[model samples]
Target: MSVQFVGLKEINGPLVVLDNVSNVGYEEMVELVLEDGSVRTGRVVLLEDKKAVIQVFEGTRGLSLTNTKTRMLGHPMEIPLSTEILGRILSGSGKPIDGLGEIFAERSADINGKPINPVSRTYPRNYIRTGISSIDALMTLIRGQKLPIFSGSGMNHNKLAVQIVRQAKVTKDGGQPSDEKFCVVFAAMGVKNDVADYFKSSFEESGVLKNVVMFLNLSNDPIIERILTPRCALTVAEYLAFEHDMHVLVILTDMTSYAEALREFSSSKGEIPGRKGYPGYLYSDLASIYERAGIINGHKGSVTQIPILTMPNDDITHPVPDLTGYITEGQIVLDRSLDLMGTYPPVSVLPSLSRLMKDGIGEGYTRADHSALANQLFASYAKVQDARSLASVIGEEELSPIDKNYLEFGTYFERFFINQSFEEERTIDQTLDLGWKLLALLPREELDRLDSKLLDEHYHPEDARMFRGA
Candidate 1:
């Protein structure tokens, strides 16, 4: 391939301005030769008057415009795809971060990616088992869905993510091949060594390493690399799911750091800001990553995403999670108060919802009554929370018999529903059975969302009478 030289015009913090570039798209990566004879990569961020602003990949630690020679790579960042990559470790930039020897790939594909045509898209229907009762019962992740976990700092979302990666599988009855039905791609951005060690240890102890691939960017790693982590992950997911015919689940943690990296790069180029000083193209940039999921027609394998983002200051309206909610299917929201109360998952079922749950659960996917049971359980638990607040104000003695019953349901909901562990894998049956156990302490007449038949089959009023008598 022939290359052209575009002399560097200026240099800034981790950024360079190259003059006379004919064809460089935004966010496209390029190659640069510094004065020290070192070759590094950079990305095109702006195009103005035949000059492009490029963000240095490894950072502008030792680079100068006077001696920097810019070589247009004529392409975007790509990821190496092969079965040999499974159980391997890589950096955020798609390089071997684990210090293992070079990986042999059957082929490599560009990570920038081509837009998936709507006509070529197939409706995602198959359910991916996450082994979390709160998710499997309520969210019911679809095979090709892009669902994100929105949580606050210090929550167990990371552990929950690891659990999902290890436990998420397509059951036998679901017609998925036992071999490829379960696989995971885990990527960590701005995470510490202990956290990475925990993930590695968890995967090792759980014996899911053979089916999992990890790409890690530690907290001390170059912040610029955070921008490439998810893209590399999505590229791997595409390869595994499409080329290898495997059901691949990709997990990205601390997307907030990724967004902040974007923000910093955008600011380095002096670009106009959007919401909270983020780029205006933030939505489209996020969409490019999220839209990679889904089952295409004629492809047996599928890619599913479970990106975990920590909401800043426990603010759901933060630009990162807020924009993510708009792009992805739905969110599994975590509660801080419940976490303080020692709940493991701390999933606030009331505010948290899965839009695709209806498509993946009930009738055939799970039990026939999963929808009604989850809905009624959510309703009863919400009422219990309300009663708890009332009891706090007026005292438990002032609460009516039914109010007291609701209070009991609330306590049971926390201990059974929210308080869960990564080692524990609960089925839909267990989730609903637990739901029934919670509802048994409540008056049956209050189950307005559930049908009479389902209530009779699942809910035992005699048990409620005994609880009331006690």
Candidate 2:
């Protein structure tokens, strides 16, 4: 039997304190019935002996200390789960909000998910093609790996996220389309109405809405709800991946918003602040989210995560990105300078990398030449930067002939390779071929990353001269 008690302890910002509460566990759900018969929901946040501090999902505004009744529901907050959750739009708290009714749940899952044991984990291999040349050819997203995109405040990370959602796919060996089930779970926290609408319309227009599960938390929504957005999305993802044996790609955008919400919630709790006024557990809290992505040894499916967070003021050293970098496998950094140059994705090549790409690509995976092509591209792009730096000091005309070739290669590389239309989707082969074409612009001696055999197979300066003349 449940116990209902009259509440008269205290009311904080979004939290209410109850005294003499027995048998109430931390994170246990609570119901607050107001004097007028309206009810609000909350969960236990802090427990001190007989006192329980509950955080109200709906802010406590009209509750009377004397007349309000509180009831403990025994279990922690859980969301209904089913395969039907795909293609549905849910609120931050995992409630259906698309004019559709509640989910006819297969089962209810705790929002705080179970941690996957490291002993049961399988090493991640293979790749999920994003269809972006720069990412596909350079920082290939390995299935079950956690790679984050670090963006600035006003950069095109949102656009990049949508593009990935639209174009991402799981491929078989040799770049053939796989028959395995793959889906995307996208959660947007603290985004404005316009941005949320844009995500919905973009997905719908691309005809990929049926494969996507979206959890949107608006800017006006309570900070408590913002904290639940990614958790809810990940819960759905885990259900699909682990239970149904499907590959799931989870994208949590603007995690900076989620961290800020945590900071505010921490302040309300009057907890001691750590670096930059954030709670001391910020790193652990982020690890709990990033570490959830991987493949289990017994499961056929995998969960790959691409968490996108904006670096405050483009400062990578900010506490949010700094801690995130320490947890995630690798980062795709967005360049403000490249964005200003009208580059679409604006991925900063030198700073961005996927740590698992080397293991995922080449041989039976993408192509035999992928590894060498990528290395040569990186080496040549580095030279382009040096050439530009020297040209800025001396005149461009004063640079050596080899340096002039690098400058031309750099311009063509950015214009053709990195800069593509929003609708453009390139295959892994197309991306690799484009890289070789750019490499052809340089003299044979400049391409030292490739061996004599690869040079004989792919290097052709005559082709480069013909293409440049065209």
Candidate 3:
């Protein structure tokens, strides 16, 4: 038999307290029946002694303290899981909002998923190509890695995310494409209605909607739903990757919104605040989400995450990006300055890298020359910064010959290599070949990162002539 109680203790912003309740577990789902007999769903967020505080998913209004009835569902929140979830659009709480109706679940899973045992994790290897030159040639996203994109408000991270979804793919050794079943799980939290429409329309127009599962939580939705958006998305990803043997790429945009929702929830709970008024447990909470990404020991499918967060005022030290940098493999940073200069992706090379790139590229992977070429590009770009600094100090025409070459290389590298159009997708070979062409503008001695053999194979000083007049 189930236990039901009449609510009376207190009603506080999205929360309802039921005093003298027994045997209620935390995070257990609840049902609230109003005086009018309309039902609302909630979960137990707090428990002390015989008292349980339930957070209603729908806002708490129009409920009579005496007439409302509460019942515990005995389990944490779970979402339906099946292969059919693909090609579907869902609300933040995993409900179908596309008028497609309910999922015929093979099974359901807890949205707060079980952590993969560290000992059972397969070391991430190989790569998932984003088809953006700056990422593929430089940062190199390894399969099953949790790499983040650090951006700022009003930047084009949304457009970049759309482009990545359109072009990302897995490749075999030596840059051959893989035929493995691949799909994307995209979750957008606290986005405006138009922004939500933009994402849906973009994926549909690109003909990739059939391969994607989207969970959208608009800004007008309750904060509780915002908190559930990524969890539901990841739950679907885990189901696809571990159970169905699919390579699932999960892209979560504007994680800053999720963090802020947590803060708001914490404030409503009256918990002590930490840095910038965020809850102190913020790091662990973030880890719980980020750590969910990786490969299992025997599982052929993998889950790779590209979590995008906006740094407040472009401050990298903000708690959201600061903690994310610690948890993720590495980051792809977008630069406002580069954006202003007409760069489409605006990936700032110096601050962006994939920590797993070293193990994933070269030989059977991307290319044998990939590692050395990336190093030389980094070194040369560092020198470009120096040359620009000198030019700023003493004027451009008076700079040394080598410095002028660096200046020219910097301009072409930015214009041609980094500033690709949203519609352009480059192969790994094409990206590498472009890197070498830009490096050709520099003198031979400056190419210290590459050995003689690689330079002989890829270096063509004549390629520099194409940029001579420009």
Candidate 4:
């Protein structure tokens, strides 16, 4: 572990230009020896005209350019992969953060590693129920898939995460091999003290902490460490799935904080700006974090990622979520209007979708009638929303009976479908049954989305009885 000095040349904004370096890779981190006798680590962000632009990990506060040296490490930051990390803690730099002893691994991995081969990709199918209806019923989260959630400040994304951990299940009763029921790899980036506390408390209270390996990068932690948070998390997840043969659900909350840290390091390095003053390599940077999720071919274990990021100014089109949407599967959109209405999940049902849901729901995975019931409820609710909009303008008394029924269905949708708290849990069959109850209000002819057999068999007077009592 001796110091390897590559020698520094000049200070440009936040960047320290390195003159002599070998095998310098993009985003490759290096160690910098300051003239004041302090050492720091930085990443090589740009290579132009044979000079490398390095973004100092520790902000340049009191470093002299005269004698500072930059030495390329010849490798990127990495974490050891092993089950010894369970019940242990780690830092954002892919090293042990908690006071627990260093985690032992059979091998180490490159942090800025290569992507899993496309030919080796295992297709995503099967649902991971997060207990919240907005996510489970509306926008289903599929196993071995990468699904990003979009939320705004003051929204209940934290609560949503807790609910997911408390309720997410890996198997479909007798269908899954007992050894493969889902475990969780939950990580937080730049989260505040109270928020971090709640995540731990919720997991412990729900009795899922034993199976979860948490990696926390608190707001008080070093800013440079934020970039390492997710990598450290995925390393363990990789170990759990590929080695221990477990299904690991990785949840990283508040990704904007991580991006901001990237921006900070980028600014310190004097790199060219991309959108909103972020680094020009924002997209590729995000891909590195998101691409870690999936099932590898011929591997018994799988790593499914549910990355939650808050949008700046509530703009979904913002770079963080926009780039994420492009890379990951469909999103679970939390609705502000639903939140104001006191809906616990606040998920906007219409816009939220799961491209991988088709692989998971219906027939053997869930109930036999899951797909038809889900679609029927969605269509019925759409009509209900339209009718309610018209009624608000023309008065409820002026609306037709069918429109009035649609209004009633809207109320039932919110009260019955979307208003569940974090602690409550429901089976997939129960969820589909509830959807059928809502569909019962509409005439049998309007049940176009459902198959005739399921409707004839399960759709009945008793189906609407519960919602009817409401």
Indicate which candidate wins on TM-score. 3
Clashing pairs in 4: 6-70, 6-71, 14-268, 14-269, 15-268, 15-269, 90-97, 91-97
Expressed as tens digits, the lDDT of each residue in 76-180 for candidate 1 is 777777887888888888887666788887877887767788899988776887778888877778888988989988888888888787778885443232555
Q: What global local distance difference test value does model 3 have? A: 0.94
- Ranking of models by TM-score: 3, 2, 1, 4
Candidates 2 and 3, the one with greater lDDT: 3
Name the regions of candidate 3 deviating beyond 4 angstroms.
Answer: none
Tens-digit lDDT string for candidate 2 (272-384): 99999999999999999999899999898899999999998899999999999999999999999989999988989999899999999999899999999999999999999
Error of 1 at 352 (Å): 0.5
In model 4, which regions exceed 4 Å deviation? 1-8, 12-14, 21-29, 33-39, 66-71, 173-178
Q: Residue 245 of candidate 2: its Cα lDDT? A: 95
lDDT of each: 0.82, 0.93, 0.94, 0.79
lDDT of 4: 0.79
104-139: candidate 3 lDDT, tens digit per residue: 999999999999999999999999999999999889
Clashing pairs in 2: none
Model 1 superposed RMSD (Cα): 2.5
Residue 53 of model 1 has an lDDT of 85
TM-score, cand. 2 vs. native = 0.98
Residue pairs that clash (backbone atoms under 3 angstroms), model 3: none
Q: Choose 1 or 4, whichever is better by lDDT.
A: 1
